[model samples]
Target: MTKQLILCDCLGSQSVDRAALSHATGLPCSRVHTALCTRAIDSAAKAISDGDVVIACAQEAPRFEELAAELERPAPLCVDIRDRAGWSEDGDSTAKMSALIAEARLAPPPVKTIDVTSDGLCLIIGPARVALPAAERLADTLAVTVLLLDGTEDLPLSRRYEVITGDLKRAQGSFGNFTLRLDRLRIVEPGGRGDFSLTAPRDGAETLCDLILDLSGTTPLFPAPHKRDGYLRADPGSATAIAEAVFEIAQMVGTFEKTLFLTLEEHLCAHSRAGQVGCTRCLDICPTGAFSPAGDSVTVDPMICAGCGACSSLCPSGAIKYDAPPVAHLIARIRTLSEAFRAAGGSAPHLLVHDEDHGAEMIALSARFGRGLPADVIPLAVPALAGFGHAEILAALASGFAGVDILPSPRSERDPITYEIALAAAMGAGDRVALLDVDTPDAMSDALYAQTSSAADSATDIAPVLLMGDRRQVARLAARTLMPQQDTPVPLPVGAPYGAVLVDGDKCTLCLSCVSLCPSGALLDNPDLPQLRFQEDACLQCGICATICPESAITLEPRFDPTDAAMSQRVLNEEEPFCCIECGAAFGVKSTVEKIVATLAGKHAMFSGNGTERLIQMCDDCRIKAQYHKDNNPMASRERPRVRTTEDYFGQRRDH
Candidate 1:
């Protein structure tokens, strides 16, 4: 059965035409309710009993879920159409509401996850005054150990938690599995006759714990501290911060689901080839230090990865991809929103992309206090805003969205987001794509509303293309669709994933060094002839070929080539083959052979004779035979010595 859409007008505050939505979405709609959370809740319960119903109100989702549990039913999918579209001040929000509903109907793929278990082993590192009190609160909940930074003078003995003093040498891992190394360590020897005494200081003490509460008041133990689970940091002087950290620490003591945010294809990674570094975008962009060089490609520690998704966006080869909801599903949602909006008589729709935390809250606040989103504006809430890369922005524009506006929160890493926007803009998007860095909800609303001009009229008619294959493939398809009339390749900014490899013909010697080191098979050598061939579409702009070139003949040109010529191999440099002197068989390059002869013909003693110098132009088999038969051949031997040992001695003795 088709899922029913149960919507509310919020006490007649917003208009929702049931007929228009039903026609636009082709889903059965319930009669508009004034108060779905109170008086009309029974109707919601009846609808919930049917299963596969979409609740149009997100604010009362908890109450509805609680009611569903009471009635022994699964929670219905809730989409906030009110704040997103219905409550907007723009007249006739039916088209926007329909688009939001259509997008919600897409069932996102199940998120991949791993179970992380914390057995409540906590390590507290701070001064005694701060660590002891925090450890005391967590003693009942967790197996606590306090590492005192200052001297343990006037300290009372305690059995509830072990106390120690050490300099934390290194801390690694995350959540349930943290490995720590401490130097100059001393453990409390409580069995002494006098007050508590510690053992002699030792170096390189190793320990393991499930959690770490760092109140050292110096520096964070890990980079991107806020993203590290089970590792909490707070200022030692701030009582409130310490208290909050303790309370949070006490609750993290069980198996939790950690989403596997990225999927890696090692073979596809262009990180390195033959020890030559190619693409390091992921390694450079990962803020949490989750990625490290394993061999040629990088490996990600699932336990430590914070899932900012900057790596996935920056990865040129599609080796690492965001997988919480998958890139395919995200594109499907974008396409659905664009298609449904136009189907419902909407024109020039702009997409507002934001994360669930900051952007959703901002939209909610705007709906309640100020004018909500415009009728032509649609909101897309992503798990991580940074995951939406240039491909997605282009997809939205190609799918009929007049423009795309990304709203990043204050906490989001702006560098990756800005780069992606710049990349998208460089690919013919121009001013159609923007990053809104407004702080307040009103400011966001004002900025969105102030935009009067729509994207170029050509964008409206461009039909959405099917987004198949990997990130690079999808990007190419979208770029092609965006500018179908343009026949030439689009010039992209430097460091773009798409590009061509340029070779200097004069400098190249057909050594085939670049072809051997190319990770993407973008560079190849002709078996029959000495030639360097390149496929521009396959070139990742990784610079491995350029770096591996012995002659320094290869260079990279970053651009997007949508023509068919990019798909096929094109010869970059070629030369006539040198024939064997004896058999006329093709061997090496003619130019290389002539150069070798010119340098070694008579100048070198080994090739002083005309016959010996001819060996330089011979094939492998011909060269070997000619060298063996030469008059002064190194393999030639004198007449063999006869057996004159025993017989000659006997004859001499007889003569005597």
Candidate 2:
């Protein structure tokens, strides 16, 4: 029997899932209970044997950091859960608990920052001391005025350092223009407690605003070590609740910047095999390009990375690791379940399910469709189908499951090729199936069985597949399946809408651009088209579609009239495709393209003699030629372009 140790009550949620733990490893409930009541990490660590699963819920009440620090030593399959107590018993708890368990199983921090910066200058003393070079490089690269104050160091020969004297007076103006009162200059070191002033460049405000916008204009940074910006405001409560919110935002932004990165490292080394390398999918999916591999090594640019685990789910080699329990852990549990079934003279097949926001639908579908199967089919909830999906597939194959099935949202089908390969591989392995849960008027169970049969002719017996669906739909589908033909009907909408644009059946090519570009969870392409819904209320009306839509298929109606659904339908349905005169390919819908072209044309007309249409007509090379000729002309003035008071289509510029 597999050994299991669970330490609970320390966390807000389950330290170990008694049912899942028992089902997977064949460990007795008594042993699991014993582990749960244990207080110290050492006792639990001693109790767990080789390849055993040990789960600890490190709640903040008892100082989670101290508990985590105490458990810094190595153990087999030790899962450390963060903020377990406050988590719901079911629903999102699995993913949350699993991730927490994964993180708890890790090591500790080694890196230290000498200083932290605010507005491009060192905001703190310690960070400033060690990060002198980094700050200097940033200043040079950005062409901004950076001041480094030192307490002990002498006036440097280098021009970068401006000596600080106590006699120097302080001069202050608005952002750019300021005259110094400096009669006394004092050289203050970075780590010194002395106060200093940092003046931005003339256009520094513009650059800083642009940078902030480019990074996280909407989302806030969390777990304010020093200070939080954007959305991460600090309120002291239980550490678990605070940590959960911080990590959620961290996962969303992809980085915690300082302490979290150290925690991530400790978590990785702790979980890694003694000789073998653990996964690094977390590093791979980082959108900020913060995490980089350096010759069998990994490095993170904290400045760049937001600590989002987008990379964690996308890493193909499993090189990236999350502080959260990976789907791999759950898959391992499933394998154990398969073994348990065999031990009990059962021949149940396992079905692993993945979804973004919900997993109940898959569970409900299993109860509805998994009738008379050889053994109980399992549904494993996964946050991302990318990294977790692949790991689960491998786990199933190893565990002797008949085949693996992948159920993804309609939006997940954006790249059909990737999904196809994943599904085909699972099918190629044996009894793998791929199904899209399109909320429709048809019975999906029969359709799934038929498709399963056709996909695998060699299989004499075929089990009906499960559907991974939206949160509400999953509930309704579950109710309907459990109580068939009953009048307690959960009225399902034809399609869910995100933001203003409802995916018109005719217009939606299933390209999934809107879902991909949506910064908010306003649009979801889960389960595939027709069934995919959009939440119109969440849309920011940014008109990102007008900017990036390749097909011109998507349009933003600035003024949405809810009274006329038909009018909206007509907008999407009746819109004509516009072909670019330069490249015959359809660029966008005619109206959107015309509007964009007109805006560009007007802007260029003010600066260049050539019209915007002519600029469009000119290729990159031709445009360069025109610019060169314009620049070389004797009449060319060096003066900046004048901003007009008159409002064009958008708005008039305010002259400074």
Candidate 3:
């Protein structure tokens, strides 16, 4: 690694942890400066010029960047150790500050962008009397199409836009590619009633429109309609709201950058296995209708995804990864911050996670007005609350954070942050719901200051460890490593990713239905024998196996296994293989085959005869051959009576 200049800021509040910062960042004592903006700017110029700078202050980043550019120096990598670690009244956060800096050194991978080009093909969905005016405003910039839901429509003012009437059945997709399913469509004609005329209604219509200006305020066409891009709906009666919508809708005609938020590993998706539906967590939680069952797998439309990351959080398989930055980068930050704070001898550190918007505002206000955060508190700002899930939460605990607090977006009230906080607590991570859901900065400070006992906050020399592998792997590892230190894993809450599958061997018969349905390969089958295998660590406990098991022999037991056995593969059920009577090849389970024969023999017509009983013991090819031979044997054939009928009839007639 290149030798870098390290600058720590007291952030105009507290004393700097110069020694601890230097020790953690591996920079020499002389090179690391406190209040880098005030003192070290002139001295650090040479290092900045060489592109070897690490600024430990996020608040002054823009100023430093400008200064670096003016000095023809490379832009320095920046991290916030102030609000995150040092802003707290807890004196010198040398260890925590150092960790933040070290974490910042590891660069995040770049994200790919998807471009959505809109040609201004707008659809106005409202009563024509209301929708026509909104369409007129956008007619200049967009190729406007009016879809009237009612029969009475206003006459067109201009010939530029097309007007048609229909009821919108469903509307989906996003900017530059809106798809609408509409029916009961009729066109406007010159001769009918007071308003105008409508052609006879016809059903089943689909149109490809780039934008939708909704005024038919009946029901939204997409989930979380506000989150659906390029589709604007407002109160039909509010003139001001409608005007604002028109302005916003007009600007949506140009090309825009749509974040490729989700990285999909289609194969890892447990949505369906062998054409049987397995996991629908992503589908159930997606605020925007981005995921749809396509064949055996689900397809996610990046264009339609609102980036809530609920899908990623609830995803049993790590098939859906929110890559605003990859999980590794986030985990790296968590590890570094936790380890650094501990290294500097900080005790019972609280990881305060917030986003860049209101959360940031509260931190700033709290610092200036209310009691600044306690020294043990460290702040981490993410793009959104959804970006980090239980994996990151438990990773914080495993890394030795005493507690976790999150400041979520306002819409979080509708359901986002609180739900996530509950999940974290269920996994044995200290619940910071009060701090996260607090209404004011002062209340936030009060909440932080009020904290007393954090069961896992004790300082232990757990070296910073990066979480690896998939979501379940990380979550399992965190629970094993941290929950033991805080508490022990018992029965996790419902929907938890841990637990074992209980199988009744008497009823199982080694059918392997559970094995086939398991998406995580938790339940595996031995090809050479009739056996079902399970790895507790891999079992997401989605109940896919239990749901699909035909014999009703499998049941889910949701419990946390902290021992090595959780990961080791074990036989859930095994039975003797039923060998084919003809080729002697193992095919079915002996018990299952016998059970089937016992149930069917003398009851079903096909299995009644003793000769036919041999068919069950033979392989498919042998059964076909045996049946062919038996039907064609001369001894087995009934004597033919066909040609005697005509001769016998003529002889009988002559005798009479």
Candidate 4:
């Protein structure tokens, strides 16, 4: 059923062309309502009761949701057309509005989540003055334990919470399951004591808690401490900070839904092969220590992962994928927006990719106060802006967008974004993709408006490509579309995922060690001959094959080969096969066998014997048989001893 779009003019603040939007979006857009949340709320209620409606007002979404709940119906999908498009200072936002509506109509992927239950056990770490006060605030709501840094303070008579003196050695885990180790630990002995006296100090004392309130006024226990859910930290000297931390800590009890941000395909991981490290991009860039090496592949602790998505963006093999909404869904949104914009007579549309929190707020603020976004600019809200890697950027460009400008929030990781932009530029995007590091709404608007024209003239004419593959495949398709005229291979940055393997034939020796250890099957050996074959497109540029190569002949060249030759296997090195001396069957490489003969035939004592040098040139079966029959062979049988045991024993007994 076609969804009904409830359009609102927000009391005549912004213009809305119902007829034009309906024509462009192919949806039943109602007449513009001046007051959808006030006098005309009955219409919204009727639409909700009827089912399958899209409310075009995001500002009043809560009221509409409440109405739906009251009417015993599902909450309608909300799209903020006002803040994103209608209120734009640049005139004629009809095309932008259509694109926004069309993109919002697409079904969102279901979010995967795990239920985490916190039993309200809180650990407070700081001096007695800070820890005791914070513990008192949370004692009623949570089971509190105060770990006092200074034991010199006078003790309180009332035991509202357990008090202990210790130095926190280490802290691990996340929100609902924190594991802590303390050294020089001492527990307060309350019985028959005028003043609290601590027991004997001990080391390596371990405890578990559901949450931690750090008032130690020192370094945080976890990296990226703000990203940790149940861990709260505050300065001991600041009473306001302590109060805020205590209040936040009090509410963090009971069951909560945690998003499983990533999914791992173990077979596709290029982390390691045969104990040799292939790729450590995820481990290197992960802001939180969520990834750990597990045998050949890496394992992610979803509980500890803050979902910065640096790992997913840098992952070469799509082994670790951001799952809040999969990469395909994001691509689909980009395609839909681009196609819809073009259909509505929009040319040279630019994508403004930003995170949900910072980006959304900026757009809303710009529309309400400052000059709104330009008509040609379409805003795309992603869960993690860092996850918008080079492939996604290329995909937007190839799907008819003239350029892509990423707006990263203060919390977003900058290194990965910079690297992805650099990579995308190397693969034909050039200056078409960029990072907009604006602080405020006015700055964001100014930066976007400054780029009045499309990044490239060719971008407007390039036909869009269907993005239906993994990251690499999508990237290749986009690259081909972007650089249709260029026949030469594009040179990529040093650590690019796409590349070719260079082998020095003089040193390779047809050893085939690299082929065996290649995780992506990019390197292979020919069964018929001593050959090293490689498919350039299949190579991950992981450097595992080079690391495992015994001859140290293998090296990597980072470049994107767009031609068909990249898809097919080509010989890197080949040698004529050596024939067996006895059976004439091919076995090893001719040059390798001759080299062995030259090195050891006359000098080695074992090979100096008669017919022994010939053994080196023969096949395995022939060599084994020859060795069994050779003089003084270890396999030669000895003469058996006479067995007259019974007769000899009887003769000895008679003599006795």
Which candidate achieves the best TM-score against the true structure? Answer: 4
What C-alpha lDDT does candidate 3 achieve relative to the native structure?
A: 0.74
* Least well predicted 10-residue stretch by lDDT in candidate 1: 451-460
Error of 3 at 153 (Å): 8.7
TM-score of each: 0.94, 0.30, 0.79, 0.95
List where candidate 4 sits over 4 angstroms from the true fold: 454-456, 638-656
Question: Candidate 2 vs candidate 3: which has greater lDDT?
Answer: 3
Which pairs of residues collide in model 1?
Answer: none
Better of 3 and 4 by lDDT: 4
> Cα lDDT of model 2 overall?
0.37
The global Cα lDDT (0 to 1) of model 1 is 0.89
lDDT of 2 by residue, 1-656 (tens): 45454545433323445565444444443333332333454555444422354554322224433444456633344443322212222232333333233333344324343233323221111122322433243333222222333343433333453322332123222111222343333343444344443232232121121011001121232222222222222232234543443333322222222323312343222112222232344443444445555433366654444433344433322334543343334444554544544443434243545564333453344333342111223344454454343334434544545455555554342243243234334222333545445452123334344443454333213232232332122222322232233432121112111125534445555455655655433456543112334554344343444344556556543221222231222223324555545455443455555665667765664444444365454445565555556645555678797765446524534442
Scanning candidate 4 in windows of ten residues, the lowest lDDT window is 451-460
Each model's Cα RMSD: 4.3, 22.5, 7.9, 3.8
lDDT of each: 0.89, 0.37, 0.74, 0.91
Better structure of 3 and 4 per TM-score:
4
Give each model's clash number: 0, 84, 4, 0
Residue 219 lDDT in model 2?
Answer: 27
* Alpha-carbon shift of residue 508 in model 1 (angstroms): 0.9
Candidate 3: residue 440 lDDT (0-100): 88
In model 3, how large is the Cα lDDT of residue 649? 96
Over 554-656, each residue of candidate 1 has an lDDT whose tens digit, in order, gives: 8888888777888999999999999897998888899999999999999999888656788898999998998888777789899689878988999999999
Query: Residue 455 of model 2: what lDDT?
Result: 46
